[model samples]
Target: MRGTALGAGVLFAGGLGGGWALYTKLSDNITADDAAAAELARYERERPTALVRGAQNILVIGSDTRAGDGNRRYGKDSGTERSDTTILLHLAADRRSATAVSLPRDLMVHVPGCLQSDGHRGEPSFTLFNSAFEVGGSACTVRTVEKLTDIRVDHYVVVDFSGFKDMIDAIDGVQVCLKKPIDDKAAKLRLPAGRVTLDGEQALGYVRARKSLGDGSDTGRMDRQQRFLGALVSKVQSSDVLLNPAKLYPLLDAATSALTTDPELASLRGLYQLVRGVRAIPTEHVQFLTVPREPYVYDSNRDQLVAGRADALFSLLRADRPVTVTKKNTSPGDSASPAFHGNTAAEDSCT
Candidate 1:
């Protein structure tokens, strides 16, 4: 999930060796500079104290907003933002492992009052987790997440549709495999079953398409997205993007353009330091999973976290322990999400 930022940071660290003159391609760009500055300027009140030194937590948000030309073409410019996807990325102090936990957007929670555009706080209410984004942007969402997980979010990165597409193209493409053919007009995606390489547009379609791809459930869609991110991690690790500036510049541009980070991580040096810690971690140590959840007891349309399991998972992260996810074998009729199902970047689509 955070592989984009991690990869960019690790690559930039090496680029820095060539001197500041070489990085003018990134620092001089107005869009990236302004966006970085905006993230630096966001104000926050409550933040959790780190339990482990050198360990870092970042919230990666996939904003479903039609604010840019590249994104407007895909959806209506509703003038409001929502988080389509959110992942909590944890980097261990030893830098030997990374854990990414996906929070369901439909999960119901209490949204606290947030600072509004008018400079006053809005009223608090109970709503879906994603609603926090619409109510007060990223900070509200962070607050909601903090309330839910009891963990401090050290930083956050928000990326929109176009930014995601651009990043995919910058890296050439991510490889994926399908068990069956897909043709979803609503998602603007079409592909035959088998091994395939998807470019920017196609990759976006693949990740966003749910109706014709899986069981037509958000959980299924999230699983697919996680797999795609796993593939992306592999691509970055194996490719020469880090060693080649020609390839690195476009990635930096695409990543920075779409990113909204916290003040501390808004600069190139700060980003580099955050990413450097995870560069040496083996791909197998990077895991992706969701907090255990089920249909809300009161509303079938919404989701409720499975308390015991969810708490256990959060506790592990809080204590800086590696989460253990056992791969479960599912029968053909099983559609239930596994208790702990996740794949490492070392495992490709075919795996």
Candidate 2:
């Protein structure tokens, strides 16, 4: 399913240039003077780095933008950006299993205090979770997550809107089973649904499809993407892409071109390590999770996620503990939750 799912992206404060050497982008108005630059230099040096061990957590993002050549052809976009998708991919210490956690963008959160690109003092604001990226980029988002989950974010990766299309096209296409017709004006999709393996454009629309999909809720959309990701991962591992050099060549090119990651993880070797670790997850043990959520009781109009449950989930990841997906409904979760699929043999065997 990894194939159909891509993490959502976008955040401007201090982003890297997809290079091995970390390149920071400063605000046009805020100049980094000598002292400020020196301090940042020292900070970079002291920034703790971790080695690949047992369980791990990596934040993956998919940028919602139409600024690239392929994206611009699709439609005009607003100047601002938002995370089209967000997923926390976790691998156990032994690398025998894996899990991908999806965080609801609209879930109201206490955005931790941080410095913005404009040198403005940012206080803890009650805003949508995605706002962390908008106000302070990946750094602030990481800070906010640390504050909320207390889980150390090892590294981050980003994928652009156009690049995702390129990836789908590069892989030829992905199979999808659609039972109903789709004609979503918002997603710019029009297709009579069935069991169809979609191409680049159609697949993109399929994953981003909101209005014409299910209930048009972000939660529903996440479910669709997660399922697709599962299918994608299955395809990659099952197909002879690696064994057949010809098939693997296009795949590698697309992956490198479409991905942007922290400097230390921008190389082919780094990617190979990551994919190897993940592939070790026996086909049965891979899983997906959504932050437990409930309707916004305080606002009634939005969502107020179940904070304690989410905290517990992250704690499990931080400790590299095997996640016990609660399947027998004791909660008010919908059928969309993949975790509720019962604790079968596949639940406990992974790393």
Candidate 3:
């Protein structure tokens, strides 16, 4: 199945990054308030659990800050860059069929009015949605997404480059099949081809190096990232870590040290339960894709996501139904040519 091995890698990565044992890590780091973390965790536990729907949307952000020792090498004396990486995973309620959609950080979006630990404070603005994180934080980003897509984000997860490495290392190493050699000066990675295992450090470079890969577009990087993630998923499912206590401990410790999640997935137990659905899902049903896109309406240099296509895909997930992306040939009026015809969704795995 697609990503079956990668899923296993992701599971180990999750633990290496940290588990519920360290759910309090993020809560402890927040300067917000004493009662805030508990309140958030409580709300997450008590949040209205939903029935398995065909699809669901999750916003995954990869922060660029190299604030800690583990991350400094990636940043290398440079200031933190924008999240450059944004992915939206649409999972069928059944947890069988899935699709990963990537959003370019440069997409011009309508940032909406938001709320945070405090009460309402400002009006909406017109800028990229990712900039919302820099301006305010999660609340603003959530509100902006709500405003732009009218999609109520059920959950949110934010991980930095350091976390990605820790997660990779926790899984021991993920095996990847490379067709050719790669040398990226930016990420400081020069690797040969073959199915070699990747540690967190090497994995980080593998995902972040774009200049030496494909068309040198962020879109190309995203494609490779998806393949890596897919492999990570497969690894997690087929591996014995979840069933092996000895291997699980170090993985959990690493993951806990590197992560900071929203209140919903703030605790180790909470995050585990949510991902448990994916862990149990079948490999063939999972797929990854970038949102349908074209050159920006204004700037030829940037890419703009297709409006109705993404929104429609999200709708299918929200409904827990099946959707098949078809390809259009080079014939007349063949503007869209979807690369993959992802399979239809099936039974809810969570159930």
Candidate 4:
């Protein structure tokens, strides 16, 4: 009997040791963006102040960097990268609501002078929004966003193509209902109409496919991306991925392996603190919308923010106030009662 008890104790200790090793491995997968933090600190006095005490604003950037191993298949090594997708994610101070506002890559904005790779400061110019990333990477993109919205970015996360695909696969694919068939050779995606579950590769192609979907406008593409993300959030929250340790480990490994984040969110503990608030928020409170924008007057291909409309939305976010959204379009004249065209996680459905 004494031998049996001793053996059980030894086995338990071994199990705990193995768990710690796995934890360390997963935590170490995150790449800390210390250089970006140092760059931002250089202009600390000029950056926006935190408006709300506990509210957090994280800039999530999808990097189109083709230099990495798994990324080269997308295209030739361009020697530079761009912010393929940028979303300013706002978490309410009370931690009851969350909003994700997608910024159009083609939106024309003032790209502030940022430090370039050549070690020379590039002159500030009004150009496409994504150019900020191509010029200076994550630091420049965060600075540009702060200047444009006057919202303090608490942190930033840059996820590459391979990481995005791996994360989707870790979740075992996400389900979406298509209204029509799609075949885009450029995006390397071909899918039939109706309900379907997309693997990582197919999911990437679906979100990035512009020409073959909608009216071939970036605006329409943004809307589609928002819906897909909402679906993803719902999937993660509703599934056993979070509750079951077996299913959760793969997700953490995949997510951490693909992330390059600010120093504040570089560890497992920091990410857990952030995710704690996110997971508790009811899915119905999770909202997704694009900033108010229209085609540029000079160039129809480019986009420009709609006057009054965009500022009003930004003001609500800056003050950490609730942002109301709906599928119905609101009156352009009534900025006082602003309800932007958007959908909530609860509203996303195949029907």
The candidate 2 region of ten consecutive residues with least summed lDDT is 5-14
Where's the lowest-lDDT run of ten residues in candidate 1? 330-339
Q: Which portions of model 3 miss their true places by more than 4 Å?
A: 1-56, 76-81, 113-123, 325-351
Q: Scored by CA lDDT, what does every candidate get? A: 0.76, 0.61, 0.59, 0.82
For residues 1-351, what per-residue lDDT tens digits would candidate 2 score against the true structure? 332111101111113255222112111111212332332234354343334455577788777767767777655776546677888877788877777788778878788665566878588898888887777666666656656666666667777777777666766776666677777777777777666677778878878776567987887788777767765676566545444445444555565576666654555444445555455566567777677778888775467767666666766677777775554355534433323322222332112
Candidate 4: where are CA atoms >4 Å away? 1-17, 328-333
Best by lDDT: 4
Which of candidates 2 and 3 reaches a greater lDDT?
2
Candidate 4 residue 250 Cα shift, in angstroms, is 1.2
- Tens-digit per-residue lDDT, 205-244, candidate 3: 8887777777887777876687777677666665465556
Ranked by lDDT, the better of candidates 1 and 2 is 1
lDDT of 3 at 105: 68
Instruction: Tell me how candidate 2 scores on lDDT.
Output: 0.61
The order of the candidates by TM-score, greatest first, is 4, 1, 2, 3
Each model's TM-score?
0.88, 0.77, 0.75, 0.93
**Winner by TM-score between candidate 4 and candidate 1:** 4
Give the CA lDDT, 0 to 100, for residue 183 in model 2: 77
Clashes of each: 0, 19, 43, 0
